[model samples]
Target chain A: MAPKYKLTYFPIMGLAEPIRFILSYGKIEFEDNRFESDKWPSIKESMPFGQVPVLEIDGKKICQTIAICRYLAKQVGLAGDNDWENLQIDMAADTVTDIRTKIVSPNYETDEEKKQKKKAEVINETLPFLLPRLDNLVKQNGGYLANGKLSWADLYFVALIDLLKFMIGFDITKDYSNLSALKNKVLEIPAIKEWVAKRPKTER
Target chain B: MAPKYKLTYFPIMGLAEPIRFILSYGKIEFEDNRFESDKWPSIKESMPFGQVPVLEIDGKKICQTIAICRYLAKQVGLAGDNDWENLQIDMAADTVTDIRTKIVSPNYETDEEKKQKKKAEVINETLPFLLPRLDNLVKQNGGYLANGKLSWADLYFVALIDLLKFMIGFDITKDYSNLSALKNKVLEIPAIKEWVAKRPKTER
Candidate 1:
């Protein structure tokens, strides 16, 4: 029997989307539990760390999106077979995460000057730094982040690039041909395409 | 033959310590490469995303410390064998990462007022949020972050608390009894103790 999994989030793709996509791609049946903003205070108390994107396995609740995604990746055999490959996948995903946290996570800055400054820094400093590196790695690894096969890291990169486009109103791969090609390839995966097509129509 | 792994970082253990610790604990041989201040620019150029703590595996370099640690954890059999356990471990490690990024990362602010304000928020908002939750989980899981065994998450937590002490000159775990106890237990691990005792000294 498939183990019961319940993912609790704020109806936003912010953190929970990757896990949701992974589970959907894997065809795993689980609950996409979203809570209203007003209900967050009460919900937050029940959460392990007062944060959402918690995955309830059987009855045990798990916190953190990467953990949940990685767990699901393992369950669905999306992670590579050996430790080295698994670590490579993790490293790729985490690189995307680093860029997100540093450049995108400060969305709460309402000041125009600060926001623009940050955006510029991201484009001028962060994007240039990461795009070329990813391109080189993709080329070297035969176009995959790990094991020369599609892994969670590849999907994560797609999601990350998609996120940057969504948030920044620009395509990161515009400058990096390999990344652009990789993103397109990942999006074309039958499971991923199907998941995206049928994904809940909501914005975080 | 064992694959060669090269880790490049500043002399301090700010971010790369956990990766180094895991590799050491696993008895995995890798180059503990450090950078002179003068060499940062050239070294930084080689890093994916222009960051430190890059891990070169079999001549392929990977970035992101959490990703590297997770990879090493898998190699050492420190991460759980199954999806559920791995997710739990990931969550624990990520939670610690969140606190570090949100609260501790801002501590580098040069502005004295802003620094103090961020530190206060960390003490008042972040610590309260994380410490109790971690304590509860530790108690619930019989003192381990996952699988009732020493995990990468446990080591991460230990490292986090140690970093907080280093940053603020105050022992955060002292208030959270469970956290303090857990830290002590992690410190007692023979490998960790030996590593700490023999770790190259730096004043960052």
Candidate 2:
């Protein structure tokens, strides 16, 4: 018999980190299948959507990061106990993704001038407009991203914050007390702490 | 008592159309609170995440379009029957959103040269890269976006296709038979047909 779960992703965390965090938090065993970048082309056609971060469950493949995180979340008890709460958690998680998307593309720009200009806009405009709102949301939600309790959304945030800080070139949580505390609270989890210390160190 | 659900959004069917489609499909009653664009600044302060398409349930508000759509999808009997099914549905739905996100921003570009360049790339590269895969998925899934059934993801795609067509300046389904069938199948639903026929018309 095979493992109950198999995660197919690049060696670095990137989009797959939340799913990894959730799996780690649950202490569930899995085959973490990380392959080299050059191997992607040969593998792309096998993917359901030609995307990395595909999670295989019981030999059936599922694509999309949040979709995989959400499916595993229910199994790990990180999901909400009810529909409304789940809605809140999903909403908060998607908002965090929205903020991340706004800043991530700049790193991929080939033009140096375009990349720096985009970085300036991110540092000056995008981060200022978005982070304060997220910070206040954490303040209102009692340091969790939703329902005033620990959920997978916080895990998702902590996992992505590394990639985000690398992209934006600073600790995104530095200016906001609530966000900083939220980051601390998530990292304090023994599972996450252990994983963070041991997971591959990537510049991304 | 207040309505069981109240959707706050702009008058146009941009982010909020799928939620509206789900609501109408379910025959669920709610206040369709469409407001003027100028009023957004005032209303923005009260919104969760300062975003529209907020679905209020029993006086509490939830933000994020897909989150609201998923919540209402369950109520409308359009959600997946199991966790695996839901995962498949969500993956497909998010893929639809991923494509939408890729092509939406160019329409808002202030510079005509950049806007046209982005449009050319979308028409030349993005559409060619993405739409056919989706076309094949619909074919493989039996005219549905996921789970080989008519889930709300199908409805979500149908609601979005019109806007995507407008943005791309052509009928996106023109070259893809399965995708064309999926669009027609979704539109032919009595509730959605009625909604589309009667809903406020907009350029977007």
Best by DockQ: 1
Predictions in order: lDDT: 0.78, 0.87
Q: How close is candidate 2 to the true structure, as a TM-score?
A: 0.94
- Stretches of candidate 2 exceeding 4 Å from the true structure: A1-3, A108-111, B1-3, B108-111
In model 1, which regions exceed 4 Å deviation?
Answer: B1-5, B27-30, B57-60, B108-111
Q: Residue-wise lDDT of candidate 2 within B1-204, one digit each (tens)?
A: 535889899988888999999999988888889999999999988986778889889888888999989988988899999998999899999999988987886765556887898889888988888899999989989889888999989988889877888788888888999999999988999998898898899876
Q: Model 2 clash tally?
A: 0
RMSD list, candidates in order? 2.4, 2.0
Angstrom error at residue A62, model 1 = 1.5
In CAPRI terms, model 1 is classed as medium
lDDT of 1 at A161: 61
Models 1 onward score TM values of: 0.91, 0.94
Model 1 local distance difference test score: 0.78
Interface RMSD of each: 1.5, 1.1
